[model samples]
Target chain A: MSTEHPEEGRVVRFPTGGVSGEVDIGQLFDAHAAYLVRVCIRLTGSRAAAEDIVQEVFVTAHRRRGDLIPDSNLRTWLYRVAVNLVRHHHRSSGRFNRFVDRYKVDPREAPAGPDVDVERVERAHLVRDCVAELSEKQREVFVLYELEGISGQEISEVLGIKLNTVWSRLRLARKAFRVEWQRRHGEGDHP
Target chain B: MSGPRRLMDDPDFRWETDCDLGDEAILHEGLELGALKERVLAAIEAPPVPPEPTSTASTLGASGAAVKGALGVGLAVVAALGVGYMLGAAQPLSSEGVAEPEAVIEQVVSVPDARLPVAAPRVPAVSAPEAHSTEVVEPVASPQPLHRAPAAVEGGASEPVRPAAAAEVAAVVMPVQSEAPGTAEAPVGESGTVVAEVAAPGGVDAVDGSRLDVEMEVYDTAVQAMASGDYAGAVPAFRSYLRQFPGGHLSTEAELSLLECLFEAGSFAEAEAQASRLLQAPGFGGRERELSLVRAESLILLDRCSEALAIVDALGERDSRTAAVRRECKRRR
Candidate 1:
């Protein structure tokens, strides 16, 4: 919702009284804000809502920058914050619940038809639908691994789940997606 | 669709599928800012707001949890009593039983003395503390801070505080007619008092004839406890405030605060009961919006969606915060 110019994101002044090593929030915003917005859109399924949440994450990050682990991955940190913020947003606003309900999204891929672009769009919707069907935990695995390009190890670090737990959840998410994708596409009846 | 038939056999087709989903493209376009690029450029120039202070222990693992819990319990008790002590007592504002506005100003009235006279040290319904914690509630050898109490906590006193002192503080408290907690405010002269203070609903009591030292004391106790994440402690403190000032000026604030404390304490049944009672009280004014917000939240927690929605509809205004609560209410409905 902020109409802040892209140029503004290029620079940031440190908040007074902040501890040392705080990230310049303006530069951080310029670097990660758009990527975060896109990630949230994928996570939350609403542009207006996603933009608002990303904005919150940036503001919160700006405040807590001093607490940032010096050697930690900033992108990973942002993902962790974005994930938590989106979860809180869902729990508090119930917007994601409504988003899922309105679209009747599930874990199955949409059926690919004869048309190419239509199939491509439906495929995109289908992937999201399938991702949605995974439980919150499983969805975290799939989103990080499949969409955000985060590795299983990084997900373990971000979610604080063990490496094996991440892989196991990812494994289950894949299985669930396979069954649903096959079923929806009418490919499971036979070869 | 045409190229993926055999690719599905690979089981690794998801990599291609992810790319084909336009996720990567969107990620690129997202970074480009596109039309929002202009918006971002404008927004980046704005100054940032101060960051919120986050609780560290809640995020940290269970390493020091036991110690934190012990310390929190100790602080909760101390805060409760410290706040109650601040309530202290008020003096007779008039000889004719008609309190004068200037004479009985709530803010300026000092505690008779920091040492509250206790006939018998009593036990609280809350958990029992060790000797040191108990001293906070009793008359002691040296004075201690009432946990940064600026208003109700007037001057200082030397000696250990006693729990009994807090419970029986009413003994030394001014006789403002405890007969009607719901109608406790007897008009203190028409001129510069009651009307002026009543209009400032949520501000500190004026040094010019306000009726909320006792209520404020208990309210502060609960508030401090809540701030420390001790809703259980806050619950009793808020209830104590309401009991001491049922019809008091800040009663509406106390009532709403009590509902919130109860809700946060996870005593949904009690919260619901109190919410229903507060809604019916004729004196519950100016707090309708907040009270309704609490009522709706309570009902939603109780799984009574239809009831919650009705309360939401009854709300007078809508903003982002209310909208969030309302969305949850509607979703639950």
Candidate 2:
């Protein structure tokens, strides 16, 4: 029998002879799924592919239950796996642009309500487009640093690049992105 | 520049900052950044399904049962096992020996000259004029003696005579190898014998030559040039690689890299041609699609929106990379 714990909503299960074992796959999924989807979407720039990748990550984890590290951070592990899968996917396809093109969603039509911030939405789209224009390495670094807000060390771990390389890529990405924004908006406009 | 430096010199740069974009714009940017982060995080997390117990139980049960069954069978079949093992071991070797020559011949036909090792006997397989197209293998039976002639005809010989010599070799050897037992003697022609003798030395030298490593080295050099924004320097390296290893395993990569080089060098037409060649190849299944997308983007950059959109439309939404590139192409259009 499985019962929910009040604090974390974790499932507690009791079996024969007072022996107890519990697995909280639901909680794990809820906490991590959204974040995983977002990372994949940003990397691939396709919501559908992101959804597919996220489903694959969970499926893979479910298959290798026994190999799960006892003390390891599951979220971080999942992210690492997702990153690797994306890299493998890119290598096999040899067509990053095509993958992005096939799965990208058009920006939703702007709503008419007063609360619907058109400028913000437009800015978001512009940023996404600008980021997409970056070199693969630059975009990765920018997403990890500015968007995900991950520390340089964590980005290094996720990307498997050296810490120095991560910093360099981040610097270059930021500079290039800023330059792009400036060019698009013209001389007087600054962000 | 001095004013900007002075602004940076302020001790409380963050607190004292006064950007041209107003507070609302800054807040909006922050919100946008947050939303993007949330999306990214959501993409990385795993799914909600609990691991299935049925698969694990079945696998374990089957393996356990197999071990027990094997132990019981071992006790009953101890007398006959030795003969069975001997036959099993010898079967693979016999089959492998029979298959070796055909494998070598196929390899000679498929791989490019630059990728072939120095020790590889040059069998004149049919060379397609266009590097990426399929080679037309002549029939193995009607040994056309004329095809065996050297690629370069003697000075006085007409262009017609050269093709005749090539045709003779193709006709003679193709039939002999096709009909005879796999281990039959090498064909009598000079090129055929050379290739056959090369196959006889176990063909380890060809594998050991490390063609991929050489290509990788050249690729790395070209990438370095691109990284430094020296598009002109990158062009020659990529072109050299493509020329040398036309049908090399990394040919797709070289083709794509060459397109990038040409684009960066502002040779838009050349880049388009390379991209067109890539799309024409049948094996450009996966990452090759991305090459086409990039090529389209280059076209967009060149203000060739109609052509770019056409390329985008051709790439149906099978993959995200293509979809993203398509979106960009459409936007530009």
- Compare the candidates by TM-score and give the number of the best one: 1
Candidate 1 is graded, for docking, as: incorrect
lDDT of 1: 0.44
Please give each candidate's TM-score: 0.42, 0.40
Q: Give a tens-digit lDDT track for model 1, residues A49-155.
A: 56655665555454344444544566766676666555544443442133224434434323343543554555666666666666767777776777676767777
- Which ranges in model 2 have alpha carbons more than 4 Å from their true place? A1-24, A92-114, B1-333
- Judging by lDDT against the true structure, name the best candidate: 1
**Can you write out model 1's per-residue Cα lDDT over B1-333, one digit (the tens) per residue?**
111122234445644333243433322232434434444444444464222111111112231232123223332333223322211121111111112212112211222332112111111211112111111111121122334433331121111111221222222122222233334222221122221112211232322223324334444555555555455565665555444433332243345545555665667778878767766665343234445655666676777768877776665322223444555665554
C-alpha RMSD for every candidate: 18.6, 18.8
TM-score computed on alpha carbons, candidate 2: 0.40
